[model samples]
Target: MVLNMQPMRTDSTIPRIVICGNLEFASAECESLFKGVAEVLVMNSLSSADLIEGMQPGGRYEGAVGILRQWNGFSHMQRAFIEALPSSVKYISSLGAGYDMIDIDACKEKGIIVAHTPGVGNDATAVTALYLIISALRRFSVAERQLRAGLFDASRVTQGRRDPTVRTLAILGLGGIGLRLAELVHAFPMRVVYHNRRPFVGAPEWCEYYGPGRLDEMLAMADVLSVHVPLRKDTVGLVDEAMIRKLKKGAVLINTARGKVVDEEAMIRALEDEHLSAVGLDVFPDEPTVNPRLLELPNATLLPHLGSISSDAQKLMEVRGLTNLRDLVLGLNVADLVPECR
Candidate 1:
């Protein structure tokens, strides 16, 4: 597959760009950015089936300049969309920080240019993870619910049992969010350790990198474990019964990354058995829908994928993503094009 790095020709046939998902928030900014250089096609999730027509022979996808995904719901359809696109589409960009929902391997195989905003939501997610850690450590969620339900008692909130010293933190897949979280948590002077597939380059002075063999060792020590890895074959269901059993009793688990990364059913069992203390999740195995049992647990705090929903991060993602797309469209090298992950 030949990759086009040169700027698309201007006054050349207008490059057709199709967008999948709702465009309520970003359509204006994106339209203003692309302006005269490209023709934009916007489709709601229901209309995506028509977009697929372009993917087939004699399809409308031929000669498309780009495809931009606003919402990450089309994982099952993404491959087909890419497959149907005419070979001329040079770039594909997602609207948010995480691109784990997209089948990047398929895009790469076709030599389609793929890019996503990273670090745009780093602080947002890091802050959310920190909140979960604190909520779990202090059992804030239970107390809040009790109060909201008018079952509140001063004694429970004041005398709730939690030993800060006994709580150890083990971060899985310590990327940008994990690293920032490590720094933020240190103000509490908490014990911090992390596990990554490869050794992190220039890890903070306070962090100790535990190799894979020592993952179990770290898990057993952790009273709180946070996950920050992307969803992939090796990562999906990375946390299972065996791994959950190793956690110290009353351990809290926080996942701000992909939901599929953790085995939801196994986590529920751990929580029910009291083997695990609490689990807080901002992402789920099946997004937009989560395990009903997880919601029933008093110890569990679940969020509707709010990690990167901050207004600031959203704006940054739009500006940065569009700038990259425009630069690439205008025949300039993108500085942060997703590098081939080793």
Candidate 2:
């Protein structure tokens, strides 16, 4: 339902923008930025049904030209919801870098421009990955668990732990987050190798680039394997049992990217047999409900999808999403369009 938090201008000539989710840090900034430019309508929607109903003809958001969306308890912006959008809705500015939740195919059919905040969360997510890498390699979580259980044997917990120094760190995807992670790991003096569709021309000289054909070779040589690929049709279950077996035995695994990119069952089996010394995961295949087996593993360092929740990252994402909507309303080309839309 549309929230009448403030008086909205009735001028049909003025463009209307709807905010689908609450901004934790940038609410005031959103108001100020679009004060004189467009009529900002806040949507108090509980589910996709509410949003779909509101976007219908002669509905509350019938006149909205743009929507700034965030995670509002809905799983995705599927084709059904997209089809319900009024003809006036021309733009969708999403809050995060990943636009997998939105159906790009549907948006394309409707001629709706989609934009996402890409670089805003890179550093925050990279730092989270770096922390996981160190924690997993050093067996920090295992040590903490042992100490908490009153086992107090430092020698036992530290028996097979390894350091990040002088190790080969293989990144599966060399996008913004992966590149930032490589730079962070370089400080530890770890050798970095990245696999991409093609060579990243902007990659640092010290970073070794491995083409798609050499993915298995890169995996075999890695002391620590970090998955950074986005979740897509081709990437779901990309790192399957065979790929997990390719990694050197006892190698640490880190995944800050989407969880479905790696085969969760295969990864769990590897960890169970001690083929992987440890694993650090920030994202899970099924969020808010992690596997019970993973929770029981001492060598696993798990985070509740906190990779991009830093205060700075949160504010930047909010501002970036709002800016995309603002730009589109002003007839300016929006930046950070999703790959499919681009």
Query: Which candidate leads in lDDT?
Result: 2
Lowest lDDT 10-residue stretch of candidate 2: 1-10
Q: Which pairs, if any, clash in model 2?
A: none
Off by over 4 Å in 2: 1-4, 7-12, 154-156
- Top candidate, metric TM-score: 2
- Model 2 agreement with the true structure over 1-342: per-residue lDDT tens digits: 233355246667778888887767787888888877888877776566777688777777777889888654355788988987888888999988888889999999999999989989999999999999999998888887878888887626557788999999999989899999999999989999999999887999999999978988999999999999999999999989999999999998899989899999999999999899899999999888999999999889999998998889999998989988898888887668887777
Q: Candidate 1's C-alpha lDDT?
A: 0.75
Error of 1 at 297 (Å): 1.0
* Residue range 202-282, candidate 1, lDDT tens digits: 788678788978998899888789998887678789888888888888888999998888898899999999888788889
